[model samples]
Target: MADVWAKISAVLPGSVDQFPLQFSDTVESSVVEILKRCRQQLYSDSTGTNQTLYPQIVVDFSWEKLNTGTWRHIDKEWRRVYSYGCLFKAAALCHNSPSAEELLQAVRTCDMGLLMGAAILDDILQVIVRILQGEVRKSTKEDADESERTEVKRIKIQCPHAPAIKEELSVPRIKCPSLESFNTNYLLPLKPVILEGIIDHWPALSQRPWSIEYLRSVAGCRTVPVEVGSRYTDEEWSQTLLTFSEFIDRHILNKEDGVKGVGYLAQHQLFDQIPELKEDIRLPDYCCLGEGEEDDITVNAWFGPLGTVSPLHQDPQQNFLAQVVGSKYVRLYSPEDTDKLYPHQSQLLHNTSQVEVENPDTERFPEFSKAPYLECVLRPGEVLFIPVQHWHYIRSLELSFSVSFWWS
Candidate 1:
């Protein structure tokens, strides 16, 4: 425990110094004020009139009060609170006995800070987080990198039976075309195709397959945001944070006992938050074909149980949806079928279609029946390329883990 505290202490000086570098002078001053107030409130023993609210609540209010401002400003303020709160918590651990509650709080605070904090502080805070969680390195960083490069083993993965959907039109499948060929054939033409043999060498597919147990072991205690409800289209749908273990226990494993609501950890840059998991998969070289650099590509993780749905919607960037663990049934419609799809008129849902593809009511949306579409059951180790603005509907056929790379 002393060693753990020492590790955390070493990271604090660097993180504290880097916090004010990226923002304006005004933001830096505000951060100093917040840090001073938070430190005083947290270390205060008396519930006096001067400090009536708890430190955590005060920090949360500071974050929530800035909601109306630009998102950039709000994130800056939020990161200061979380990052300083994390530092204060780590300091407290040095003087007192470390409790599980305190350690968990420190871990969560650092996780929140990383969501929108200075890039310079990221690696420092990440190391602090692992130390507080008592996660030991299996090997030195150098050894781990060398092993990953040389010791990749491809083993057979037993995938569930592909869902039975009569395909009137199927997306074309290409077997690992060269990047130049891919750019000329698919990217230029704006067509959707599934490329096989692209992700065969990923450690996630071979050495460290993303089973429930494997995920639990590596990232069980890490904090992550998850969407709760049947689907995002539902009125009750909302997002919440859950530990990876809790998400699996309540949503994935508990589904057999007939769990009611769905919990999806969707559209999150989980790789940035958990670097250990990021090492298991390499970014596809094809992302270089985009105008932006590889770092500009938006990578998201989608993990959920069977039957979770991403209703028919389109994105603004070209996407590479890589199936890692289980199969998913994907149905796509070209932008030419936009009028036939009956997109929602509301500003919030303008990009989403109102009609559900599988069980569309022909009376209400008769044109949807005539909308020509392509469909496929995407399997593990396959990468599905979706062009910009192409409408896609996806449903998990089994417990699934998928990663998507979106780039312009």
Candidate 2:
């Protein structure tokens, strides 16, 4: 515990000192004062003022600057401020001897800042996040080990939606075709296909099969943004950060009875954050079919409980949706049928369809009734190729972990 605290305490001072220009004088003075008060609290009998309090307010003010229409072009200063607030907030909580959950929240704050803030702040906080994660893993090791040893049964895969759709409409399937064959038939024609046997060499499929326990042990303490609701297009949809174990307990294990909402860790650049998990997956050789360099490939993770939905949507890049655990029922419609699918008018949701694929209302969207589509049940060890701009909807059939690689 002493060593843990020492590692945690060493994170901020020297690292932050390296980037003198990163923090404005006024910001630095305020942080210095708060940190001074935090150190004072360490020896005081009673808990001193929480230096961690103002960072959230600072974060909020910095966040407000992103409300401008041209947010992509936002001044870098605000991003730096946001990162500064998050990093020191973690430091303050550490000095105050925060609870395990408090430490986790501090890590979450830093992750949010990293996801939305400046690149300069990344090197400063990376060590802090790792140390916090290590402390969390140490605290939860006993419970995690016990839970891992206990085998909990899972419900079988269920494809209760859209039962009447034609089996003939299923996406074309094949074993690992030659690169030339794949490019000639599928890539050039912009066709969707279910590819098999291509990822047999992946450690995720064999040595480190992505069980609930394996994932929990590997990344349970790490904070990730999770989508809460049936689907993001719904009115109640929102995103919040949670540790991987928390997400597994609430969403996967169904640990809390009577909880009605879904929580999904969807479309996150998880490989970039946790490189250990990255070692388990190999970038498909098929990505080389693209004109871009291998570094241009974008990998995202999707994990969720049964019945989580991704509404009918299209992406700009070529995609390989790889199923590592559980299964998914996927439905796809061509870009030629875009008008029939009735996409949302708002610029924000322009890529998403208003009509639900399985339970679409013909009275409201008559054209949707006539839209031709293809479908499949993607299983573990199978990868589904989705051509660019092809509208597709997906629903998990059980507790699932999937990786998607996107390339042009």
Candidate 3:
């Protein structure tokens, strides 16, 4: 498999490989020639077709080296490029009919000129590379010669904090209920509410014993191990047993491969079998919104005994995490406590010290000593919501399956 993929990869030039030649001053001339050829092919003066109209150009490239020496035959691979099919259709629709003002209006209203420009650039670069080098190689010594000579400067970005809450000198203070109430009131007021027992209601677990087995089989579990976490290889993760019953009896029961040997589960199948889980899943919707929307949403699920103790980091969206089976411990800090967390030097808001939260290296993250936090134990069937820009770390307690939904 590795050899086959290596051969295939060697034959294709990825986008990054074509980047250096793309920005050359020669690109403009290449685009003009390609566009002119396209206009001629689609609308010729002899045919009485309008020459003023711009026809969309689809450009492609390939190469072959002639050998004079050997009688032996060797097949050489060639690279091919197709204009994004959509671009060609769009170009046909906008053909020479629209005035320059009308075209400018269309380009602005549709906002696709930039995308068209980028595609044209990509196609132009491929052709230029082929014209310059008769044969395509993964990379060439010429690439080093053409490398940008300018020094790159790093720019620092700053995140602005919300305005401070004004102190009310005249208003009377209300009393708290107990020590726990006072602790909640004075420290970490916006802590997450941890709920347990949601998994008990999951239909697959209750109605079918085979469902449990199937899940265990998919998870590659024999006797559930005592230790908390594990990671699996890709091949171990792809095996499919259709019904939950076949999964448990056939896959789970036969565990010659140790539990830890199991890799990631089939993500799509996991969602397909548990359709109800999709309702709560939040995918990033970036098209209509502005910048940062895409990076704000990320979902990750884990099956099998495993725990990830990530260093504290603040995200823009709130998190709704559900533990399907097993238990985990969580510790959280609020946005206001940024000063106490000992953040990084960059513009990133939360400078979560790289030191593990469970056991900190006080010498390096001395400011963490000033940070106050709330801790909770989340059990199977429960959900916990970590608020926007809050910091947290998780540790799995036993064999577990969990899903996390994050959104603004």
lDDT (0 to 1) per candidate: 0.74, 0.79, 0.40
lDDT of 3: 0.40
**Candidates sorted on lDDT, descending:** 2, 1, 3
Candidate 2 at 47: error in angstroms?
Answer: 12
Q: How would the candidate models be sorted by TM-score, starting from the highest? A: 2, 1, 3
Q: How far is candidate 1 from the true structure (C-alpha RMSD, Å)?
A: 6.6
Per lDDT, the best of the predicted structures is: 2
Task: Please say which candidate is ahead in TM-score: 1 or 3.
Answer: 1
Q: TM-score per candidate, in order?
A: 0.83, 0.83, 0.39
lDDT winner between candidates 1 and 3: 1
Tens digit of per-residue lDDT, candidate 1, span 1-408: 435555655665444333343444534465556566655544444344433233455346545644557765565545555455555544454324345665666667667656644333455667777776553222212132443223211112335567565745888999999999999999999999999999899999899988776787677777898898868999888888888878877887662376458999985669978887899988888888889988788999999878899999999999999999878999999999999999999998999999978899899999999989899999889999999999999998878899999999
Error of 1 at 385 (Å): 0.5
Off by over 4 Å in 2: 8-17, 23-73, 95-102, 143-151, 155-167
| lDDT, candidate 3, 133-227, per-residue tens | 21112112222122111110010111222222233311112222243542354223545655434345455345432223334223221112121
**lDDT tens string, model 2, 258-320?**
766899998556886776799999999999999899989999999988889999999999999
